[model samples]
Target: MSAIEASPAQQATVRMAARALGRAGLVHAYGHCSLRLNHDYLLVCAPMPPGLIQREAGVVVPIRGELPDGVLGEVRIHQQIYARRNDVGAVARSMPPSVMSLSTAGITPVPRHGPGTYFAPSAPLWDDVQLVRSTPQAEGVAETLGHARAVVMRGNGAVVVGATLEEAVAFTWFLEDAARVECAIRAMRLENASAMSAEDAARRATTAGRVIERMWDYLSAGDLELNSSHA
Candidate 1:
């Protein structure tokens, strides 16, 4: 009952993403994560909470088609993009507290903080967390992310995509970090807005990418047993 007919390596990446996001506190038990097996196909997690969703069984759904289970509405956004572009591989939807809270309050993450944060001068389709109402709405959203890392949903949360699960999870981590930094900076009302400039954010995106590769290694090794850590 697994979704999609993917290689063991691809499936392992899916499980790794679930565990890493749970550990990073992005998942709850209801949120969803998916990887594009190909432009017309993907592997979706079962319906459940963000942190607790399981892959033991899922509805292998295909684009240009429909499933009896009905897809998550939020997934419409990702599906729309995959239907149009072949560049994106993994997509995740989660309501991380900081990003959620910040979006509601109209706060912005300053990835300009350093080379570990993922924000930018050319990030795309996002300014103060623009929230699109439907899947087709994401078409405009993708236009903005033409080459940036991720995009935020105004007052909702975020949808992060990358070439691999590891890349996607890493973006999610820094997205949170950027949020954390913004929260702290605002609480203190510090005058270092320049701390979040564009140049620094791109640099950090690069560094964060490397850090995530190391994590991908640890995750792929099978020594961590991440599933039990959550149980």
Candidate 2:
């Protein structure tokens, strides 16, 4: 439990995470990300390009799904997790190339690689990844992501959960970056045999998780205004 205050700086950091996700090649207009606010509401992407996601200033909605009618249809994707998972405070979804490729191959994305493994992240694959398919799918994801920070959608995409918006966005960016690294490392290993040691990987994950957590704390403390509701 580090000091995570809500302030403008925290919001900006969350915004930067969306931009980073795009820069890391985790954007598609269809993908989305969200941050839970005080267990009552959340702030999320505004149906724009990953790069523009931050520029548009994310939309705010109830943690209990009190959004206005006719908003992004995929919004339910997030609702699924929030309604069922009590531990998470934020959520993110992405259709990154490597992840999609893995999903298509039916192989799934596991945390064999990651940005830093900070935030106590774990990248598990879900069976039915489509968020809007059924109300139950989201619940299933929420269940899998129970207390963890990340889950990659099988044959679909990826989702990252956190204790705050900053942590969620950090997880999103880092996961995409890690996916890229994993894809490259995997290719190289297949070609030859070069690789990073398990010890190094574990060390990085632990360090990365803690760093993300602190940065998230700083960001949330700044973006106190973006909170959808005090609840």
Per-candidate clash tally: 19, 19
- Please give, for residues 136-194, the per-residue lDDT of candidate 2 as tens digits: 55567767666666767776777777766566766666766666666766767765533
The CA-based lDDT of model 1 is what? 0.62
The candidate scoring highest on lDDT is: 1
TM-score for each of the candidates: 0.78, 0.68
lDDT of 2 at 6: 41
Error (Å) of candidate 1 at residue 192 is: 3.1
Tell me the lDDT of model 1 at 225. Answer: 40
lDDT (10s digit) by residue, model 1, range 21-74? 776787675466778877678876666664454455444567555533556655
Top candidate by TM-score: 1
